[model samples]
Target: MDARLAPFATTPRLVVKIGSSLLVEGGAIRQTWLASVVADIAACRADGQQVVVVSSGAIALGARRLKLGKGGRGSLDDAQAAAAVGQIALARAWAELFAGHGIEAAQILLTLGDLEDRRRYLNVAATLDRLLALGAVPILNENDSVATQEIRFGDNDRLAARSGQAAGAGAVILLSDIDGLYTANPCEPGATLIPTVARIDDVAHMADGRSASGLGTGGMAAKIAAARIAVQAGMPLAIVDGRRDHPLTAFAKTGHGTVFTAESCTSARKAWLAGRLTVAGRLTIDAGAAAALATGKSLLAAGVVSVDGDFARGDAVEIAHAGSVIARGLTAYDAPDARAIAGARSDAQAAILGYAPRAAMVHRDQLVMV
Candidate 1:
């Protein structure tokens, strides 16, 4: 157990990353191991903690279902096909396990752009918060079926850290085949595990670029990359040996893995958004919307009186009331579409536009009062 890992119990929100090897064995799902991990999540929930899972193994499961040879699928198309088939099975497996605990599992697939784009990032962060509020555990995976090479994140490790950042998780855990960072390959004699990492850069050279499992893409180097992201986002990260059952619980008790302390604290969510985003346009809101914003309520379409500038969906915009700037946020509709639906009831969105997407002109989660 590591002495510096005493703060694990206090985390209010946690993001857990389950690797492919931890979930799949012999071309099949590791049901017993998964059940134990689910138990760990339920326990966390019981203690009033919100949990999100960033999981891998879809392509592996899909390949097994299609009976593809184990070594590697030949091309991106082959991998995409496998992921398309396996994603369903993976979702079902998670749903079934969570159902036993009276917990709902929500599936969310994302591409690399979702995190990189400020508007899309805010939308995703809002969605994660909503799911947690509704007592549902978000199960996120890369949209591998539709992701091309240019937009693909080859490993879930980086995605896990991004998930924590998006959801404002207090902690991030990576369950892997190896417990922690090692001075050298553990398979070789004289290699020793490093219990705690105060600075990832100092130990960056210790990563031994080990071979990845046939079912997985990330290696130790990828996990290191993830740790860097988590620590920068004000959350401690742990890399634990997850080959055994009750992995999370074991970690809680022993704290035997390497804990990477956060180097800095993240700013408030709205402040962070305000600092990073560029306004795309402006929306003139009525007095009612201005009042609602003060009360932390979502900006409704009916409150919007005018739309200014030509901006597309998921673009940041300003909200003005009484000829004064009130707030800034991401718009759910394009400028033309916003004009068509402005000041209309949410229920009227479908009729006003050919197809209604979201009810809010700008969801409250993405909006920050200026």
Candidate 2:
């Protein structure tokens, strides 16, 4: 056990990548095992953490439903067909499992292109943020029904890493059939688990490209690649055994997983918010609000003096004070609504907007002081 894995259970935002090999077996979903995983997720939610799940089982489950040969290569059409059928079952199963714990589950299907394009990436990020803000856990999987080799993420490992990056997850957990990385395939003799990876390349040769289960597409190589992507993006990742009951809880308590540490990307996130955004409009705030933003506080509607521009919710906008740019951030309300609520108290949000949304016009997490 290692203390380094504690963040996997304690981080404010987490993305858990569940492999199909661990989730499905013998032509059906592993109900008992999945229940245990759900329990772990429930525990995380109970601790006030937001979680996003990148699940891989649609193709495996679909193949079973269609009576396709298990663990064998199939035509792209066949794979797509299986995904179309299996996705429904997978989503339903996840919904049911989370519902047992009074948590709502949302299904989001995407392809590589969705994440590769800048505009679509932002849209996806916004959607995930909204879902988390609404107290719902998003269950994501690749949209296999229409994906081809050229545009598809060959494995869910990379997809999970990218999804976590887009959602700004603080940590990622890869629940694989194996416990963690080893000098060699653990199934083989003389392979010992490596508890921590400081520099992935130093041990990149250690990956034997072994996939523990026929149902899962990713192997050690994929996991390593995922680790590289996540770490560079400032999100720590962990690879742990998922076969046991309450695996997440166990890993946290026993520190049994291989933890890949990475620095937080606060400056990078702020830079993106400040420079990469296309200013959709402007929000003129009072001097008090400007000072508050300088201190890293979210921009409140109470401090907003005027709203200009035709920006929609989630669009990036400049924050102005006395004809000077103070900060920039994503708006939580549309231009019309923002105008109506300018200079209003936080408590009046619901009454003024006809529905309760966020308290801040620009959340601190999405704002950058310029």
Candidate 3:
């Protein structure tokens, strides 16, 4: 193990996600625990490291405060109601904690749309950049009160991974109830902790049918998925126990956690594009277009051989050649418009479509080189 690569030993931009199980105890927010976490954030900032926090526990806090049932899982409506009530309390607690240390904290609630849409995605990134530039800590959380099943971050694990990509973070630390990943259930005989993981896929095989403790929603499965996202975006990740004393500080200094190594680093735009779960349409380009894409060039209408599916401007679409996808991008024009301009020279776009939105079917900036 490289000592410098340990979670606490090195100085790098980091995104730390603390789950509900860690923030709450006996169905209430643990103020002492939260204070420790805030202190750790203060320490990181003092070292000139940028930190973003993705937190879960709004619903839990709200449920407790509203006296809505006790423990166990709640209905979707119940969860949403709890989130609505608890989000304010969550922010207030975070604000107070940071204020104690003379640090400013900004609450940023985001839904899936904030990440999936190109315009919204860029806006979120810009906002975060500005916050960090001003030396303020940004507290991120999924906007569960307004998000439906169709558009949700699903869990904070995934949200933290996306936030790391958005902020160009060098590492993401997942503070969970457990210490680290194990080869088998830690309670079972012969199970052992796997301290370092080069590939997240390997850890997935070990997860099998495990589920998280009653206090949290995410299981080993979600953590592995988050690690995969971070690794692909060229951001290393560590899953460590949050219950420990000075958890974040200890991890940073000792690197004592389950570390997942990054695979390949990608730019912010490309990372956002690659992380997209769905594509709205497909653009079939010719061999020449494929060659041009491989060499990092814009996709001109003249090189497009065909268009498939109905996609509006700014929608995610796949760029293909001979039925194989070569790239993916946000479309510059809608489906019908793209079809009319396909195979036409760039200068002839206006003549063919009677007013082209853009000369290129997919501008280089909008396209992700796969």
Distance from true position, residue 301, model 3, in Å?
A: 11
By summed lDDT, the worst window of 10 consecutive residues in model 3 runs over: 3-12
> Candidate 1, residues 239-324: lDDT per residue as tens digits?
99899999999989888888898766635555444433246699998998899999988888899899889999988788899998
List the pairs of residues colliding in candidate 3: 7-252, 8-251, 8-252, 8-253, 9-252
TM-score ranking, high to low: 3, 1, 2
lDDT of 3 by residue, 295-327 (tens): 889899888888889889988899988877768
| True-vs-predicted CA distance for residue 175, candidate 3, Å | 0.3
lDDT of 1: 0.84
Q: How do all models score by TM-score?
A: 0.72, 0.71, 0.80
Q: List the residue pairs that clash in candidate 1.
A: none
Native-to-model Cα distance after best TM-score fit, residue 195 in candidate 1, in Å: 0.7
Query: Where does candidate 2 clash, by residue pair?
Result: 2-255
Q: What is the Cα root-mean-square deviation between model 2 and the actual structure?
A: 12.1
